[model samples]
Target: MPDPILPLQADQIGKTYRQGATTIHALRHVSLTVEQGEFVAVMGASGSGKSTLLHAIAGLIDVDAGRVVIAGQDLSLLTDRALTKFRRSRLGIVFQSHNLLPSLSAEDNIRLPAESTENLDQEIDDLLDRLRLSARRNHKPAALSGGEQQRVAIARALICNPAILLADEPTGSLDSVTGAEVCRHLRELVDDQQRSIVMVTHEPHVAMWADRVVVLKDGNNLAEFVTDGRRDPQSLAKEYHQTLEGEVVR
Candidate 1:
């Protein structure tokens, strides 16, 4: 059989910005691939280009060089209109803020991504149950806890049944206990539903939840380590620091 196609492939991506005569390199030859059912975390310090890499893969911004392929479709080749449709149907994104409308109920929030509600009742219902928000389906954002609201956001992202889930600081706003709960749900989505996730998080604890962590430094792919069932956040942090230290000495 042929090798399976990757859920996401980013090759030699580079992006830069200019302010007058100053050139700011946000990313430098960064490449990453996420496999099916795998959870990969991108970790970096501030200004390390982690978020830039995520935005590049999601096609939120254009990369000056390289290409991004999602589920076999090359993002750079698509026209503006086609890219919009492709992104909507192929990628699921969760951000730091729940971004839920205060006026809409949990179910309504999840249904927002649907092109039409007429035929999506069952799909929305199923996603609500899967995300464990069935009971809170009628509640508005203000009526739900932080974790619940985030779960609703996840459900909204999944409603389209996208091939890959891209999250940026997904648990940044939640308490430790609630954040852990949300992480568990993300893990289950990979293990049970065969979903692929690429998350950008600065928190070691959050990165530990992933199967592998990819570290970025100074706009480069610095290192990566497999978690291998190690749940201790400190171990990951130590490894991250050591990787940076090694680079410094080189």
Candidate 2:
């Protein structure tokens, strides 16, 4: 048999931004691979280029060097229109903000990206139920609580049935309790549904939910460690700091 296609493959990706006379490198020779049904978290400080890498994988920004291949298709080989269509079909993205339309109800927001109506109702109902928002389906975003709104956003992201889900600081706006709840739901998706996910977060508490964590610093992948299904937040936090400070941690 041929080699299995991964959910995500980013190879030697480089990104640079030019501001007049200054050029800032956001990513330098960065590479990441996420297997099917794996949950990976990318952790970094504000300027560490973690977000840039995520966006590059989502095809929101072009990388100056290297290639991003999702499933088996290379993003660099697609035209702009093809990229947009492919992204909509193959990638699910969730940001820090819920980004739901205030006027639309929860179910409607989830239905926005849907391309076909065949079994659409059943699919939307299933998503709402899976996210535990079945009761809030008719409610608009303004009426939902922070966690609820975020769940709706997640439901929206999954509506497309994409190959990979990319989340950026998914819990940044919620309280600790609510954040933990969202993280639990994410873990459930991986364990129960075999979803492929790549989450970017700065908090160890959130990163601890993933199967493995990749730490980034100064636009490069600093270190990576497996949670091994048992690493606690406190210990992971310590390991994260040690990795950031250029210390070895096993």
Candidate 3:
């Protein structure tokens, strides 16, 4: 049998911020591992360290303790410049805000990341078409709907052909119908492209899209709920809510 591969891994990670005498612990000994081609969701309430954990794993912030590895490279050993190159080449990030440039068209937005590549055009229209944004390729961020803008962001992230994609509250700003649409698009990308995703979200509906769900609270990973196959989101949401309620009672 072939050795299993992991795109991202975190071990005993912790982060703390000192505001005068009051020290706030943002992530508390959180540990997570994402295998290759797996879509895993990290779910938590506000201030439950979901974003903090994402930042730590993405190497956007320094952790006071523990270590992180991305694409088999030990992040702790890399210098700042090397780390930046490593991240730019292997990790993709999508935010809730869509973060598209106002002046760039949707196709241009998706191709921006490819500029850093060595003689690679990466066919913007093909990507746009796959994302169902081909018709909207000429539109700018201001011209597109919220769901359309997020799809552009996803196309941009995937344009790099990165080893892993990190998404934080990707559907937090969208309406219910639009959010579901975005989720379907994400599923297509992951299933067809063999892309691994580590997503942070509060919505159980969003979390259910993942192959496995990791529950986080008080700065640590608590549990995992996985389905036998691809389970229905509606049923998964009911169980997730019940699991959350039980946690509250304990």
Candidate 4:
């Protein structure tokens, strides 16, 4: 069952960038709520305000109006320093790039963030084992395969034990096979651990792993997939394509 209270909630959020006389409205009254333990995918074409929305939710950029709440705190109310600390403590983010340090070994990369803390050594080790990186522990990023590198990235994200996981185009840089594998791993995390995940992507297969899928355009959420949580991810992809075509013809 979906959670009653939202782990992530955005209420009429808005963002505007000023380029001289022109004001770029990246997000227009965007509002969304991701329940605790729910897996949700945000899907949209390029320039559809997908990245901007993630940034706003992550507190990378302050919203011009409205409010964003994560783990029960209103982000707009926090000071810059407090917000930074809050993000580091409670938020988990994964980008398309593996972003592993060139000199760091796979194990080190996964357990890397633990270096900042005195306690978390055991937690880091457990995550390394969970991601199946114990075998390639000493291998550097350059020596690891694409899938391995992404797994290391996932380990890094989980090492923090964040309240909510946010991924932006996580599989965009991988091949079809590797992307599917990444999705498989994510599904396991959501199901086995009951982790809350909100991924931003244009791929339907990626969205299928999610319990619910949200479609966005021009910073506004369009329609949503609210059923068939048991359906295959590939079928969800096909339906998303059909929805796109139907919108185009209208």
Candidate 5:
């Protein structure tokens, strides 16, 4: 039997931009694959192309070369309308900003992405319970804490039962303790629900929550290391910097 289609496959994707007389290669033949139920974090310094790669994988921007396939469907093959619909159905995106409406309650915010509200009451309730927001379901964004607001964003993303969840600095705005809470919730989503996630973060503690870390440098995939049994953030930081410095990590 043939192998099953992967959740995400970004094949040698490249992107470039021209700044007046200078040419900038934002991404250069960078490839990444995310399997089912895997949590992968991409780390890099400024201008390292990690954000570019995330945008490419999210189908938010078209790559200059290569192709991005999500759940067996090629993004380049879809028209604008079809791509929008496909993205809404198959991809969940969370950003540093919670992006929740200040006037809407937590429950209503999560309901915004549902194509059909038929039989959604239980699902929303389940998500609220799962995210430990059952008591705050009726609270508006202004009434919620930062971590709570971000969790609301996460629930909204999951409302569509997306094939993959793409997060860009999901905990960037919260305090350290609150950020760790959010990360733990994300980790639970992967461990308990078998969700596939790809996140971009510069913090070692944030990246450590992922099952694997992919480091990018100078628009190239520099190295990657599994986080399993790697409990020390200082060690991970050392390895990450070493990788960025063009040194091999044992």
Candidate 6:
């Protein structure tokens, strides 16, 4: 049998920006692949290109070089309109801020991506139940807790049934306890639902929940390691620090 196609494959992705006289290389030949049902965390310090890589893979911004293939479709080849449609159907994104509309209820928020609400009612209902937001489905963003809001955001992202979920600082806004709750939800999405996730996070505790951690430094791939949920957050943090220190020494 042929090798299975990955849910996400970013190859030699490079992006640069010019600010006055200086050139900022936000990403440099950064390549990553995420398998189906796998949770991969991209961990980096500020300006380490972690978010840039996520944007590149999601086609939120154009990369100066390299290509991002999602489910065998090359993102760079699509027209802007086509890309937007493709993204709506194929990609799910969650951000640090819950990004929920205050005016809409949680169920309405999750139904935003569907073209027709009539057809998606059952799907949305099932998704809300799965996300454990059934009771809070009618609540507005202001009425929900931080964790609930984020869970609603996740439900919204998943309502489309996208091939992979791209999360940027997904647990950044929550307290430690709430953040852990959100992380466990994401892990369940991978292990139970066979969903793939590529999350960009600076928190070691959050990254520890992933199947593997990919570290970025100075706009390049620094190192990667499998976590297997065996190691503690402190050990992961120490390893991440050592990886950066080693890169600096070299």
Tell me the whole-model lDDT of each prediction, alpha carbons only: 0.92, 0.93, 0.84, 0.83, 0.93, 0.92
Report the C-alpha displacement of residue 101, candidate 4, in angstroms. Answer: 1.2
Model 4 poorest 10 in a row by lDDT: 241-250
Model 5 residue 60 CA deviation (Å) reads: 0.8
Model 3 per-residue lDDT tens digits across residues 1-250: 9766689889999999989999988888888888877888898889889999988778888899999988888889989998887787788999999999999998888878774655345466668888899899888899999999999999898887788999999999999899989988887777887889999999877887898888777776766787445547777776666666665332
Model 4 reaches what TM-score against the true structure? 0.90
**What TM-score would you give candidate 3 relative to the actual structure?**
0.91
Q: Is candidate 1 or candidate 2 better by lDDT?
A: 2
Lowest summed lDDT across 10 adjacent residues in model 3 is found at 115-124
Candidate 5 structure quality by residue, lDDT tens digits, 1-250:
9998899999999999999999999999999999998999999998899889999998999899999999999999999899999999999999999999888999999999999887799999999999999999999999999999999999999999999999999989999899999988989999999999999999998888999999988888888988885657898898888888879664
Instruction: Give the per-residue lDDT digits (tens) of candidate 2, residues 81-139.
Output: 99999998889999999999999999999999988899999999998888899999999
Using lDDT as the measure, which candidate wins? 2
Cα lDDT tens digits for candidate 6, 63-144 = 9999999999999999999999999999999999989999999999998887656659899888888889999999999999
Score every model by TM-score: 0.95, 0.98, 0.91, 0.90, 0.97, 0.96
Candidate 3: residue 121 Cα off by (Å): 4.0
Worst 10 residues of 6 by lDDT: 241-250
Backbone clashes in model 1: 0
Residue pairs clashing, model 1: none
Model 6 TM-score relative to the real fold:
0.96
Whichever of 2 and 6 has more TM-score, that candidate is 2
| Model 2, C-alpha of 12: deviation from truth (Å) | 0.4
Over 4 Å off, model 3: 115-122, 229-234, 245-250
In candidate 3, which residue pairs get closer than 3 Å at backbone N, Cα or C atoms, i.e. clash? none
TM-score of 1: 0.95
**Which whole-number lDDT from 0 to 100 does residue 184 have in model 1?**
91
Assess the local accuracy of residue 42 in candidate 2 as a C-alpha lDDT between 0 and 100: 99
